[model samples]
Target: MNIIIDTVVKEYDNVTIDIDGYVPIDIKLVDSKGNPPLYWRVGDGSKSLLELAVLPENGFLSAITLVMMDANSIHKVGNNQVELSCEESGLPIVNLDLWKDSANNDFSQRFIDNFNCDMQVYISEDTILIKIIESDNVNWIHCGGGFYLGLNEEKNITHLLINSLTQVDITNFTESVC
Candidate 1:
């Protein structure tokens, strides 16, 4: 199996991951002064994958480790949200604006309660799109997509698309090999 990670940024960065089977993943968080402790949770509707806790220090930054087994799980940690999907071919797209709505009246408290960490406030109505595609002959088990900000205002809305291919030997479950 293979894993792919993708990131996108408008005013802030957004990341997505794709994986096959169950795998352990490690994430890091920085302990910024005057900020609340970071926390993470994975859930599908009411089903949560983890309990809230302070991220552990792993070397330079705090880390959040998880062994993922489901593809439909959504992870919300600090100010970031992640989702996984399985796709064979073609381009996969993701939008980065679904995180928070600063224009809403309860945005402040809601954002604070969810992330439990300090976050920079940026009030701009912008949206970013990302796409991912397979690029090599090898069969890929994971894929990701994201975008980043640009220098110029005209170029500020950036789009990033990635294609990944793996060389892992694939096995068919139905065919019994001797």
Candidate 2:
């Protein structure tokens, strides 16, 4: 569903994070409040979570790595809070909607905490590109969406987009989902 903020159409195709390897996708998000976009990546749309990122409106941010746990379920609470939990624990692994009044986030911590390895961060085309180095030869990684991982076979590196693309709100998922 395309979110509308201040009567301005906010769609995913407007801002796309085109990386070198994987195919860029226009992220679909639901921003309840007038806040920024919230990206959730669940592995195969199953229980395992690959990443959960909150791009802080692309402004000032701290370099702190906030270690977050993987969650299975995510939902909005009272239109002001987001609770993510695993195994129906009734407790959220990480509760969002609390960072609204806080400072901006670099999202480096969420990468490290999710992958459990050291990663590089880069910002280009108004999106955060996370560089993860793996020794194994891998290709075609899909957790959130389709990814053509072998962008460079020699490098064997994967760069995941950490932010959402903004476009004019047009596509409606209520009738036919993309």
Candidate 3:
């Protein structure tokens, strides 16, 4: 099994990470020691977890919301991209860009330029995970006079974890998010 981890730093404390291969079996939000954060409960990936007012650490704001994808649900669109869709409606929820360029990949950079947050990736023999860290410094643009959640930032944050039961699970198990 092989694993690869990538990190990206963007403006306004926004970050996005793209993990290739592997599939996830479970997801959770834990502290630096891997213990569950106080007053936080795991939820299905249908809504925003940040709205619950999960407090910040030190002076920075952060949240971990997991999107569990059945391994059979992912389809490769190209050599550098994968698409995950809603099983019931077949609507796309996330598009992973894995484009590899010279020296640097444009996928993470493009996400940073677009979202402006810090991102981390965790890949193991059987799981590919993405962690997005956002801070209060981010400038969110509210559209239609606050009719929407706001733009210029990736809100309703969710981490896409591939289910390990899929045929593609091959990496050695590794514990992330501690």
Best by TM-score: 3
Q: What TM-score, over all chains together, does every model reach?
A: 0.21, 0.21, 0.24
lDDT of 1: 0.23
The model with the greater lDDT, 1 or 3, is 3
Q: What is the model-wide C-alpha lDDT for candidate 2?
A: 0.28
lDDT against the true structure, each candidate: 0.23, 0.28, 0.26
How would you encode candidate 2's per-residue C-alpha lDDT over 92-118 as one tens digit per residue? 112333344344554432332233344
Give the top-scoring candidate (lDDT): 2
Residue 160, candidate 3: Cα error in Å is 6.4
TM-score of 3: 0.24
Clashes of each: 4, 5, 11
Q: For residues 66-147, write the lDDT of model 1, one tens digit per residue.
A: 3321322222223221122322322212221222342243433212122221111111112111211122222221222322
Q: How good is model 1 by TM-score?
A: 0.21
Model 2 pairs in collision: 11-167, 14-166, 14-167, 15-165, 15-166
